[model samples]
Target: MTFHKEDQVLYLMAEHDLATLDTVGLKKDFRTGYDSGVYRITHKQWGEPPHYAQAYFDENKHLLLFSAMTDRGFEQLVEAFNAFGHDFPAEPYLRVNLTMVTTANEILKKKVVLNEYHDLFQEDPDPESEKVLKEINAFIALVLPDINAGRTPGIEAAIRKSGIDPENARNVMESVMGSLEGLPGPKGKSPRKSPGKSPVSGKQKKLTKQLPAQSGEGVRLLSGDDELLFDLHLYGMAGDIRREAPWEYLFEDEVFGVQVPGKDLVYFVSVMGFEGEHQALSFYKGYEGLAGFLEFRAEVGRLSLLGLPDDGMLQASTMTGGLMTIPHLMLSFTDRDDLEKEDLAAIKKSGARFRGKGQWPRIEEIVPGHVPVYPSKDSLTELFLVVQQVLVVLEKDRYDDQYLMREEDPDHTILVRVPTGKGPRFRWRDHYLVVDPKWGETSYAVRISPASSVALARLPEASQELQLDLFMLPATVREKGSRAYFPFVLMMVEKLNGLVVSMSVLSPQPDLESLYESVPQRVLEELIKSGHRPSRIEIRSDLLFDLLEEILEKAGCRVMWVDHMLQMDEAIMSMISHLS
Candidate 1:
C-alpha cells in the first residue's frame, strides 16, 4: 500500500526518540571491477513463511525479514532459520523483525539473480470491480494506521464502502486520496514550509551534499565495455551505508585495475566501502614501472598483507603480517584432528595421508570440518581421497620463503592469494592472483577431477616421477556427464604461467567406454599414485585426441599432444558454464 512516507516519519520518531536501533553487520557484498545494483536473495531450504531472503520487497520469501539484520546476523539468521524448517518452536511473542543491512565475508558467495519490476495492480474487470475491491481493501486498513498519525482516509469509510454517494465519495478519494494530506503531522513534525524553504531545509542540503567531509568513501568512473570498460560508485562512504551486503575486496584490483606498462594509461581501481572484519586490503602493480602499491593491514581482528612484491613503488600503508593464511574446503572431511602445518603438507605431498592424518582436518570454530558429509559411493570416495590430499597440500605450500626467494631472481613478479575453489566454494581473498616464475621454473599441482575420482585414485604402479604437466581428457558424450559424472577430468598446469593447479575426481563409469577404457591405466595409475614422474605427458583433446593417442601409445607412457588444448577445451567448457 504505497508507503515510504519518508520511512513512516522516521519510524514514528523511533518511538519517542533518544535515537537508537542496532543489529546490522554481515559483510561481503560482491564486486568484480564494475557494474552494481545489489539486493539479491534466495537461500531458502525450509523454515517456511516467505523466507528466501533479500526481500526489500520480494521475489521469493520464507522468513528473512531483513531490514538490515545484525544481532550477530540475527544469531546466525535464527540458527539458519530453525535448521531450515521442522525443528518447530516459533511463537515467542510473535517476533516481527524488519530492519536491514548485513555483510561479512570470508567467502559465502551465492549471487547472480537480478530481476525486479513488480508493479501489477490491475483487477478492474468490472461487474463493478468486486465492490471496488472491497472498497480498496477498506481504504487500506483505514489509511494504514493513519500514516504515523498524520491522518486522512475517512470520507466516512470512503462513502460506505464504495457504494459511492457523498459526491462520488469526494470524487473517489479526491483522485485516490491525494497524497494523504501531505504527510508529517505527528511527532517528528514539520509538515509544510518549503515554498520559501525551512521544511527540512531541502533535506538538510541534500544530506550535506551526500556526506563525506571526513566521513570518507570513494569509487569513480561509471560506465564501461571497451578495454573491459567501467561502471562504479560506492560514493563517499557510500552514503553511510545502512544496507548493502555482497561486498568483496582483495584489491577490488589495486582499486579496480590500472595497467600502464606500454602506456595507454587507462586507469581502473578506486572504490572503497569495506566496513570491517579487522582489515587487510591489497594492491601492487609492478613488474617494474607498472609500478604502484597500496596495502592496508590491521591485526588481532585480523587483516594482514604486510606488503612486498618488492614493496617498492607508489604508496599507502598499514601493518602486522603480510596476509597469507589459506584454508578452503567445500563440504566433507569427517576428521583427522583438523590437520594443519600447511594442512599436513597438503596431505603427505598429495598422496592423501588418511594413512597419516588428513581424513578430517580443518577444525575451525571447533568441529564441523567442511560439510555434505559421506553416506557412501565408497564413503564419498574415501573422503574424496582425503580431500585430494588437502588440495595437494594447498598447492605445494603456496609461496613465501620470501616469495619463494623472490621467485628465484631473473625478472621476477609475484602477486598471490591462493586457496582457490570453484565447485564447493572458497576464494581466500583473490588479489588478482598472478604469479610469474620464469627462471628455471617449477610449479605444478593441477587437478581437474572426475574420471570417477581418478578411477578411485589409481597409482601404485610404483614407477612415479614425471611431474610438469597440463592434462584434460573428457571430450564428449556431451562433455562427459554420467557415471554420475566421471568421464575423465584432470588438470595440473605449470608450463609456468598457465596458473591453476589442483582439483581431483576420476573413477565412476557406466559407459563412454568405461570412461575411455581407463585412460591409459588411469593415468599410469595416477602417476604411480602421485609420486608424479611426468617429464613427458602433455595431452589436451579436441574429441579425445585420437583415442588419447592410441591409449597412451599402448601404455609405454611418455605421452604428448597439446595442440593448444583448444584453449584448455574452451577454458574447461567456460568454467563448466559458469559453474552450471
Candidate 2:
C-alpha cells in the first residue's frame, strides 16, 4: 500500500492473498512532497506500525482520508478485526464508509459509489447488521425475477422514492447493489421505476418492547408471572441442582423490583433458592422481558446476552443451578399442546420423573406459548445442533472426575449429573439449581474457562487420561480397587483444580498422608528445574492454596489474586504476610 502527496491519491494493492503487509511503501519522489508538508498518511494498514500522516481530501479539499505507514500500526487495526476468528467487515474502508454515511451526504454518496470499486473485496458481515442484510438480500433474490424481467431498473431509486430516510440510504444501497448483481443489462438499461414511490420504507418499526425485533413472522406474548409459575422439570441432566431444590423458592417481600425499559408493566419471576434466600435477580440483567426465562446451562448465558442467534426452529433461555443441578429443559408450548397421547405420555413421564421429586414449581406458573418441552424423536436428531449453539463446555472433560466417559463411546458410557435411580428429585431455579436426595443428584450446569476448553481438547493425551469419578460414592465401595476408587480421587482433584500426575504419587495409596508430604518436594524441584514458569506448576492437590502461598513467599514473588466469586483481581506484595 502506498500514499502519494503530489498526486493527492491513496493506493492499496496486495502482493498476494496471504500477504500480511506491515509498512506502507512510498516512492522517493513522493517523499519530498510529504517532507515539505504537501501531504500525510493517517489510517495505517493491518501490519504496519504507526506513523504521523496527513489526511487526504476530496476535490473540495475538506479532509477526506488518511493512510497508515507503519506495519505494526496496520497490524493493530487488523488484529482488532480478526481476533479469535470472529466475524468482521473485510473491507479496509468499511469503518470509513460507516463514518461517512452518518456524517455528510456528499461523503455518504462517495462511499456508496466506492462500494462498486470494492464490492468483490467485502466478505465478513457485521454481526449487528447481518440479519438486516440477509433479509434484504433474501427479499431481493425473491424479487429478482421482477428485476430481471425489466420491472425495475434501480431499486435504490425506488427505495428513495418510497420515502426511505436519507440516513438509512447506505444500507438500502447495499441491499439494492447485492440484489442488482444478478440483473440483466447495464445499470441504466433496466426498467426504470419512479423515485416517487420508494421501494424501501422510511423507518423500521420501534422494537422498544424487545431486543431488536427479529424479522420472523409472528410475535408471541407472555407474562413474567406465567413463566415463573410453570413447573419445569429437567432430570438426568448433568449437575447437583436437584439436591439444591429446597433452596429454589425463597420468599420475596416485593412483587417486582427490577424494570426493563420497554417492559415496565411486568412482574418478577422469582425462583426460591436460585438468587438468594429472599433476593431475586433477573435472568440476564436488563433483557429478561424480551424472552421468557434466561436458559444458562453452559457458558451459553454469556453468549445469549450478546444476542447471538441459536440454530433451532426456536431457541429458549432459562436459569438453573451451577455444577449440581440437572439441566433445565426449555419448553415450547406449540408442540406440547399438539402432541398425541403417546407423545404426551412420554413427556409427562419425563416431566413426572423430574418434577415429582418435589422441587419443581406448580404447573400453572409457566406461560402458555412456545416453550422447550421434552426432547422427542424428531427434535433429538437436531438436539446436538441446538446444544452446540446454546451450550458450550467450559473445560472439555473437566467432569472426568465425577463422570468419566470413554473416548470410543461418548453416548454409551458418559455418566452425566442426572439422578441415577429414578423418581423426581431435583429443583429448578432461574439462576441457581438444587438437587435432592443427595445420592443420585447431578448438576444441570458446570463451569470451565473458554481458553482451556478450546486448546486442551485437541491433545491426544487428554482423551486417554482425563476421567471423572464421583467423590460421594457408597461407603461399601470406598476400599475397592483402583478402577472403582480412582473416580472419587479424580473428582476431588478436579474440584480443587489439581493436575493428575504421571507418577502414581497422587493416585490413591494406603499411606495417604506420608505420600502427600514427599510428593510436593520432588514435584516442586522438578517443576522449577524444568524451566516451568511459576504460573504453570501443577500444585499438589491437598496443598493447592498452602503450597502456592509457600512457594510465592520463598521466591519473593508478588502475586495477584483474582477471586472466582467476583472475578476481581487484587495484588499481593508478600505471600507470607498475606497468608498470615
Candidate 3:
C-alpha cells in the first residue's frame, strides 16, 4: 500500500503462484514493491523494511503478498493474472490467487484463503490488527524513509523536534540498524521458479497458436499485461510489428470493437481453454444494446457482479426481476483482415468445426477493406485506448424529479424492443411470473422506486388519502390465455410527510376481469386503512368507470369517468411516469 503523508486506509494484496509456492519470497516481494515506489532503498542490507512486508500464503495455494496505493492499482494486481499470467512459463492461470487485505498488517495477522473452487477469498479484516497498524502508521513517517535515505542528521533533527536528547540520536540509529539485521531472511534475491521447467512451455512449443484465438479477451485488474495491454504471442502467430506505427495519431471512432473475455454467465464453464471460453462467448448476452453496457463495464469482476445469476439474461430488471449479464464485442468493427485464399480456407475449416456450422457470424465473414486487421502489435495497443473511449457515455440523464428516472436507472429500465420469440417474464409485485407476449412494448411501462417509497406506501397511516383509477390500454398478448387489452391502474398514495410514494406497476394480465376486482380491492383496503376514502373515484375511461362501479360498490366508493381534469391529471402523471 502506498502510504501518503496522510492516509487512513491501506490495502495489502497477495498474488500467489500455485506453480512455485513461496511463503518467504512473498515477504521479499512486498518489501521490494514498497521500496521501489516509495522509499529510496539504495541497499537492502542496511535498510529494514516495515514488518508489513511479512506475508503468509495459503498452505494449499502458491501465493505472493504485497500492497498497493490505489484502488486501480489493487485492481490491476488482479488483472495481472488475466494478462501476462498466460505466458507459457507462468501456467496455472486458474490457480493463481490474488487476495486483498484492508490493512497492510493483516497479511501477517489474518488468514486469506480461497474457497474450495478458488474463485473468491474467504477472509476479511481483523479489527485489532487495524488498530495496531494505524498506530504504526502514525509514527512511520518519523523513521523509515530517513533511514533508507541515509540521512542520520535528518533523523536526529526529527527526533529533536519531538524534544528527544540530541546525543541519544546515535543510539536510536544503532537500534534501527540492529532491527534491520535481526529480520528473519537474508537480504538477497531468492529464485522462486526453476528456469525452463514450466509444463506449459513444453506444450506451447508443439502447437502453432492462432492470434485472436478462440479465447475470450479480458482485462484482469493489474498484472503487467493490464499495465501494457500488449500480449500478442499467440499459438502459431508469426508476425511482429516491423516498425511501431503512429497508433497514437488515430481517432478512437475509427475502430469497430475490442476483444473481451467471456463475461458473467450462468452456464457452467468447466475448462479455461479457448474452446470453452468461445462457447461461453456464444452464450454471451448484452442488455438494451449499449446503455446497460456502460454501467456494467465499471462493475466488471466486482463482488456486485457476482450477485443475481442472470440465466435468461435481463431485458429489463423489471422484465426479469433480477440483475442480468450481457456482453459487447471487446473486438471492434475493424478487427477483421483480408485473408489469402488458402489461409482463409484453413481458418474457415477450423471455425466451422468449432462452431458446428458451415458459415460464420456476419461480423466474422472474410472481407477485404471492410475486415479488421489486428495482427500487428500497434493495433493491439491501440485497442485499449479505442475501447476506453468507445465504451463510455459522457452524458448524464437529465431529470426534473427525485424518482429514479427510467432514462437514468441502467439497472432497471430496458428499452422494450419487441422480442421475436420468448421474451422475459414480467414480475408483477413478486407473485405471478406472467410470460404474456401481449406484455410487449405498447402498454407496458417500467421504472425504479426507492425501497423507502415502497415501504411508505404500505404503512399504517389511516389519515392519508389515495384513489385507484384504471385506463384501458392494449397489451400485445402472446400467451395461450392473454387478452388484447388490459386495465392499467394508478394509485396515488403519499409517502412519509416529505418522502414521495412509489408508483405501483400493475401488470397487464391475460385475464383483465380477474384483476378488475383485485385492483379496486387493493385500493379500497388502502383507503380504509388510511381513513381517507374519497367521495367519488374520478377515472378517465368510461368502460372502466362502469365496470369499476360494480367492483368498488362494496367498498362504498363512488366511481365516474371524466373527460379531462387538471387536478386528476397530476395524479395520473405519476402513473404515466413509469413509461419514461
Winner by lDDT: 3
Model 2 C-alpha lDDT per residue in residues 1-580, reported as the tens digit of each score: 1112222112221111221211234221122123221233233333222232223323223322333333333334344424434343333331122212222222112222322222322336445344433443343334345655857545555444444333344443443443243122343122223335322234331112122212212321211111111111122111122332323333221111112112222222223334543211111112232122222222354445655445210111111112111222232212234444654454444333322323332121111111223444323322222222111211222222221223333222211211111111122111111111232222222222333323332222211111111111111123444322221121211123233322221332342233333443433343333332232222212222343444433442222322121000011112112634
Counting clashing residue pairs in each candidate, in order, gives 76, 98, 40
Model 3 residue 158 CA deviation (Å) reads: 43
Question: lDDT: which is higher, 1 or 3?
Answer: 3
Q: Single out the weakest 10-residue window by summed lDDT for candidate 1.
A: 99-108
Cα RMSD for predicted model 2: 25.3
Predicted candidate 1 versus true structure: per-residue lDDT over 325-355, tens digit per residue: 1111123233456544544443443222233
The lDDT per prediction is: 0.28, 0.27, 0.30
Model 3: what TM-score? Answer: 0.20
Provide the TM-score for each candidate, comma-separated: 0.19, 0.19, 0.20
Candidate 3: tens digits of C-alpha lDDT, residues 459-572 = 443443223344422222244543233334444433223122323445545333344434544554445444444555555443345445654544455556543333333444
Winner on TM-score (2 vs 3):
3
Off by over 4 Å in 3: 1-260, 265-386, 389-490, 493-524, 530-568, 571-580
Which residue window of length 10 is worst by lDDT in model 2? Answer: 565-574
Better of 2 and 3 by lDDT: 3
